[model samples]
Target: MRLRGRKGIRESLEKQEDLVVLQPSLWKGRWSEYFGNSNPIHVELGMGKGKFISELSILHPDINYIGIDMYDELLRKASGKVRFRREEDGIGLDNIALALMNIQGIEDVFAPGELERIYLNFSDPWPKNKHARRRLTHPGFVNKYLSLLNARGEIHFKTDSRNLFEFSLNSFADLKLRMRAISLDLHSDGLREDLVPTEYELKFVSQGMPIYRCEVVVGQQSLEAHEIRLKQEGRV
Candidate 1:
């Protein structure tokens, strides 16, 4: 469902420099200053169309939010949403920033222990076994996240794909990581007041599909053990 080849999309994104960060790596380790406050920074990794992050920014002005996506069209659309919401709500855009970049280079954009939380909303399933390495929740990516997150930081994930959800659970377990707030049917009892459903989540829920959700907390011991395992497996 990604928008493709929309003319002038790149230009549109360039014009959104106030909202879109073109050189995120330069801001590494300085996100707090970029946001002009010491507010905890939260990221919507692989944020698609920007609906969820935009809503979250509006809901929690106390937090600094970054939304990252690889597609220029998606980033453009997300910028529009944030801009419209700002005007609609009369809120300044200081708390929100968008980046158009691939997630694999995320470490270059934020220094170690820079992030407080990361949201993975409806990420690509990458179902094939050969492609498992590319899944965001894969152990390799989890290792990268560990390097970027503070000691107590957490990764919040939600998805409608059962295969991906099961894989993620096992992946975290393999690292001996701690997980909490697991839900096999997130909206079954009615949406939580604080929850802001992503665009894909809303579509799937309307069709009676279940959403799987979990939060993985960063633990020093688990991280050390996971790194050892990776080294033994010649993965690190």
Candidate 2:
């Protein structure tokens, strides 16, 4: 969706040619060069309207963040938020960037061992069995994530759909991924104090819908095998 208000932010984003990567192939091996450092990188796929990523960037300025979304209309809104924060804070928030791209081409945008973490917030469930491949937790997408994630990289997922959560659990088990942290009802008062609530998570919780959350680690062996298979097939 097109962002409303903040015309100045829109203009600023228009001039920030280097901050937004429109080309997917160029992102494969140029992330460090683009960010000007080799600091840890984190990504949020399907960053809708920028609330979650923007807030996370503000919370953690030490690590670099990239918000990926294919819809230019929605990305423009996300861009406006990032630019506005940079202008208002005057803190040179250079750690954050936005990309107009799809998650299917994640490997094309990030080199091997590039990402430290990935966030999947409220992705479409694609509930039908025929559309299972489109689910973020599906084997196909998990393989794509394995291509760019570091050996111990973590994937954080939070969703309101029980079907998607169950499917993701099964997918991770089938893939033999080691899952450390798993929460079936994130809204419970017993939740860890360290948990950071995303925009969608907060809304869902307030509406009395229990959120599902989990963290999966990509082991060294799995990482190596994933890389070899991707290289052989030439896509992740």
Candidate 3:
């Protein structure tokens, strides 16, 4: 949930220097360098309030994590969550960074092949046919993601919206991306290990909503083919 136009919201975000970087261009291609490590980088593409990625960084300290969200309303809350964890634990996870950017402009901030993994969690469905191209799983965004990811890189996606899940599956297939894992009902499907519930994920699971998940691998060479298929489908 958005904090809804909190006064000085931008200033609040500015105070969170230990957790998020509001201006990320300086560390664009040198992201891993900011972390002082060569570990593989993974990004959560639409990290609303970021509960998932923060926990993920704690769990997989060996891997670097970046959380990108467009709203300061969301980032402000996420920063507080991380700061509270640090205050209580005496050791906040250091393997994480946050960026505020429109997903479409991500290409301007990161070099091609910079990410080893990307996660799209409960993205906006953009359910109407006219708005389909704006969906995060649309071929346009998928192609951009593929370009940013290193060869053999994988994207992990999760959603509670069945329509979006099905749509994303078709998007991945259209790109001929290989799927290594899929779960139509993740919480009850016997794939419980390593499942770190995001804030929204917890709410949905509490209400008995089924969560959909999949892992897709795309190669750099296959990108052109995906674009060709998009034009063929008139999705362009």
Candidate 4:
């Protein structure tokens, strides 16, 4: 998913001071010092080209944002966008940062109970029975998120694929996560005016695809059960 003719973007990212390089193996427990704030932290996994998070950072200056993607080239493009916005508009978007890392290593990048919110925007469906474990909604990744999320944290998700949406719904239910809100078609009838469009979300809407969205709330009971299971499995 690397973009061609991105030399200018690469140079822009290199010049950006806000884009943080998060090497999971090295910065396992040092994110708090990097941000220098006890304020709530929000993360977007598989941030793609970073349209959603970049806009979000501009909209929410109080909350710190961390965008994660595995592709170095994609992140470079995303970082370039953020840098351009800051340079042109003097947006002072210092609260946002980009990390080149995989979601599976999320625990290694942030301390336990550090993230206040998580966003999953149009992640790869990995639509095969044999690849179920690779899906972001799978229990393995859910457990990882549970460990990192605060007590009242929530995970927001949006996708245009019905199969992936259905699979994620079932995975949340199986994990005992309560769905606080859901919209089968985000752009129809009455939609929130404050809703911002992601890069893929906008494309999907233009193509006549319905975007499904939901928020899952983490409960104390579910957290306790997760902790017990983790202990029993020697995960702690």
Candidate 5:
């Protein structure tokens, strides 16, 4: 999922220093200080073109948002749309940040309990059974998310891939995680207020693909298990 050699991509990313974090590692555990607010942080993994998360920032100023992706080209495009008409306190989109990083390396950039919520919008289905673990909602990735989320944090996932969605549900159940908001035909559910359509989501919906959605929460048992893993990793 690499898109290189895009003209002005690097230049634009460099120019938007306030919006994009070239090196996110420096503020791994201290993101509150980076945003200069005690607001809870929410991150969108694989935020293609960044429209959904950017608009979410505007809607919820109390929650800081970060859009993470692997390509600077996409981030360059996202940086353009993420800008608001009048940023809060002239701080320049006060509650938003973009990071250039791979989804698999999320653990290296965000500490346990640092993120209040995570969004997986139209993630790669990774349809091959052998590559199932590579999917964001796979059991392995789910465990990583468990370690990253706060006590009450949850993951809001939306995708058009039926296999991926079903796999995610089964994975959450196997891990003893709490699941809610399970919807198959999202547009018909009358949960419009809760629906924030990503770029891919809109296209899929227009094509009549039933969008699958779910929210996975870290249950008490899973949280305790994650704590044990964190202690073993010396992260607790």
Candidate 6:
């Protein structure tokens, strides 16, 4: 949900510059340098409220994380969560960074093969047929992700919308991408200890909602196609 514009949202975000990356595109292809480590990078597209990313970063110190959100209010709120975790748990926030940007401009921030994994948690379904292209799981975005992920990289997607889940699976199939660990009801077997829940996810689970999830692996053919397209467009 989009929060109302709050006063000083920009100032609040700026105050957390240590955790919030400003002018992130300049660091494109140099995320490891920015993190001061060569650890694999995992990014959450549209990380709402930052619950999942912050908790995941705290759980795994060896891997780096970047949470992207377009709204200033959301990023501010997410920054607050990271701060609270750092103060309350006495843990370092070196492995995590929050970026305020739209997902469509993601290519300007990360180079090809720069990401180890991408997370899609409760993304906007854009249920209308005309707006399907705007869905995060659309083939256009998936192809961009394919170009960005390393050979072993994968996309972990979760949503409460059945239509969107099915649509994403079909889109993957059309691209001949391999999918694994699909769950129609993610919590039907009870929540797994390793699973991290987002703020919306927690609320959905509380309401007894069935969550859909899947992992999409990059196929060689798809990767080659992305490369060939990039070359054809003179972007490579």
Clashes of each: 0, 0, 0, 0, 0, 0
Give TM-scores for every candidate, taking all chains together and pairing residue i with residue i.
Answer: 0.90, 0.83, 0.87, 0.85, 0.87, 0.91
Per-residue CA lDDT of candidate 5, range 1-236, in tens?
Answer: 66766776787788877889988988989999999988989999999998899888887889999999988888887887787533433545789999998878889999999988999999989899888879999988888888988865879899898898889999889998767669988987543666678888778777777989987767464456656876998976
lDDT (tens digit, per residue) of candidate 4 on 174-236: 998877558899987543468878888878787878999998877465457656876998978
lDDT tens digits by residue: candidate 6, 77-137:
8998988997898988899999988899899999999998999999999999999999999
Candidate 6 local distance difference test against the native: 0.90
Comparing 4 with 6 on TM-score, the higher-scoring candidate is 6
Which regions of candidate 4 deviate over 4 angstroms?
Answer: 1-17, 22-25, 190-192, 219-236
Model 2 per-residue lDDT tens digits across residues 1-236: 33354445545556667567677568677777778888888999999878778767877888889989887667777877777776777766578888878788787778888888899989999989999999989999998887788865888898999999999999999998877558888768853457666667777777888889887878575467656776898875
Candidate 4, backbone clash total: 0
Q: Tens-digit lDDT track for model 3 on 14-125?
A: 8777678888877889987788888989999888877888878777889988999988888877777766666676766578888888888888878899888899999888
Q: Please name the candidate that would achieve the greatest lDDT relative to the true structure.
A: 6
The CA lDDT at 155 in model 5 is 91
lDDT of 2 at 105: 78
* CA lDDT for candidate 4: 0.80
RMSD to true structure for each model, in Å: 7.0, 7.6, 6.9, 7.1, 7.1, 7.3
Which runs of model 2 end up more than 4 angstroms from their true locations?
1-14, 190-193, 220-236
lDDT of each: 0.89, 0.80, 0.83, 0.80, 0.84, 0.90
Candidate 5 or 4, higher lDDT: 5
**Which pairs of residues clash in candidate 5, taking residues 3 or more apart in a chain or in different chains?**
none
Question: Which model, 1 or 4, shows the larger TM-score?
Answer: 1
